[model samples]
Target: MGIVRNGHEASDRWSYIRRFLGGVAGIADDFLGWWWRGKDTLSPAELAAAHEQWADRAEWRLAQRAEELASDRIKRYLVTSWTDSVAYTSRRLAAQARGELSEWIPQRERRPDLHTEARAIFADILTELNIQSQPTKEQSSVVHLRKAG
Candidate 1:
């Protein structure tokens, strides 16, 4: 968490704030891989082909989302990160689908990291959109103050 410095002040008026989210994604990737290690279900070549297919699907979807959010540059950045992440993970999953890669391998298991990194990159965009993990009391506080008057 950090202050967001806009062209104005740092009194929470226009300053930027940093946010960190999604510890679960990273943790789950590790746990799932560790739990499923020695299972070879398909040939390496087939796995590679599946991975390629998954990557293609992910990339196309991501591009579409990016286009939808094009009006907002900050939002675009966040969406782009998300799309890139899907593409990256899809590529790897495609490999897994072909059985060329183990489900528990480090790279294979760390899929959540890709998402986490994307979220981090998109933090600013999220902030601009006013998205939050939880609702803030600021709105209620304002109402309370109004009633007191």
Candidate 2:
């Protein structure tokens, strides 16, 4: 038989059991409360609004990216064209200055229309240069929206 101490031992054992059970109950209650708070509570309209806002932001970002790419392409084309034109003009002017045109073209043949060629080349260069200097329409197409506080 188990030892008995005037019911004191049984009482102490019951107290320890109660304390352990109470701690477990408190923990369970806290977990349930947290789970309830963490549950999805958004209405359909709220969810839809959030999605629409995300899509709008995405579209705006894509448009901005496209504009940036277009600007870069235009810049590269302009620079390359300008460099090629400068090289060609330098070679032609140097050859003409050195009187090497006769070697390239027969003297008996009518001289090639240098004035017309020069005018055409300069016009093309100037047109492209002017275009490079001006802002593209895409740059101005961006819409600025002020956020409401």
Best candidate per lDDT, number? 1
lDDT of 1 by residue, 1-149 (tens): 32433321223221111111112112211213322442244356654554454345435445646556777655665656555565666567655566556454343245566556556756865785776654479977887889999
lDDT of 2 by residue, 15-59 (tens): 212211112112211223322442234344433333333333223
Task: Identify the runs in model 2 with alpha carbons over 4 angstroms from their true place.
Answer: 1-71, 102-149
Best by TM-score: 1
Reference-based TM-score of each model: 0.35, 0.22
Clashes of 1: 5
Query: Candidate 2 lDDT (Cα, whole model)?
Result: 0.38
Candidate 2's TM-score reads: 0.22
- For model 2, state the Cα shift of residue 69 in Å: 11
